[model samples]
Target: MSDFIGDWYALLVLLLAGFLPNEVWRMLGLWLGGGVDEESELLVWVRAVATAILAGVIAQILVLPPGALASIPPSLRYGAVAVGLMVFIVAKRSILAGVICGELVMLIGKWWLG
Candidate 1:
């Protein structure tokens, strides 16, 4: 603890500056959404908007990723996404399955390509 001041400070900053703020909003959302009907039009619209935003972000990442992700070929990235989607559907919309499969695909593709 005494020797790793920088690492501890970074962790503290991450918890205070990032995790706490996100957690507050998440808790607020949970409270606010507690009474909202799942079938309500507003909820549906919000879900759609959130999905669209996520899709857009994913598209942007695939198209023009920053850092090391950009070094991977576009084909590999797109192929991973496709495989992930397939796994997602085949696995009964399991997000964990989709993400794990997608990451595995990306890693294998990168290794194979290299």
Candidate 2:
């Protein structure tokens, strides 16, 4: 849109704000990972930190969702996740099967409950 094109400085700032953290982390990972062994303490710490951050984000989403998922009950949300995991494990980690099974479960739940 013309408005967006006219606001090029704002767009540039937004782009940099979004990209810089990921770029910094990627570059740092490349720098540190080049010489480091997989079992190194720093690598382990980084992995643990990343896992914790991801878990926190997932927890927040589950506990306090926004958008369409917010309309679904927490129990159903967790149930879908559990069912998806079971399907994934049973199907030897087939991503498609897991996704389809989870979506099917949600659809069924919505139809039956709503």
Per model, state how many residue pairs clash: 0, 0
Query: For residues 1-114, what per-residue lDDT tens digits would candidate 2 score against the true structure?
Result: 896587778878877998887899879878877676879898799889999999999889988998999999888888887899899999999999998998899889988998
Taking the tens digit of each residue's C-alpha lDDT, what string does model 1 give over 54-96?
9999899899999999899999999999999999999999999
lDDT, candidate 2, equals 0.87
Task: For candidate 1, give the lDDT of residue 4.
Answer: 57
Weakest lDDT window of 10 consecutive positions for candidate 1: 1-10
TM-score leader? 2
Candidate 1 Cα outliers beyond 4 Å, as residue runs? 1-43
Q: lDDT for each of the candidates?
A: 0.91, 0.87
Residue 93 lDDT (model 1) = 99
TM-scores, in order shown?
Answer: 0.60, 0.78
Spell out the clash pairs found in candidate 2: none
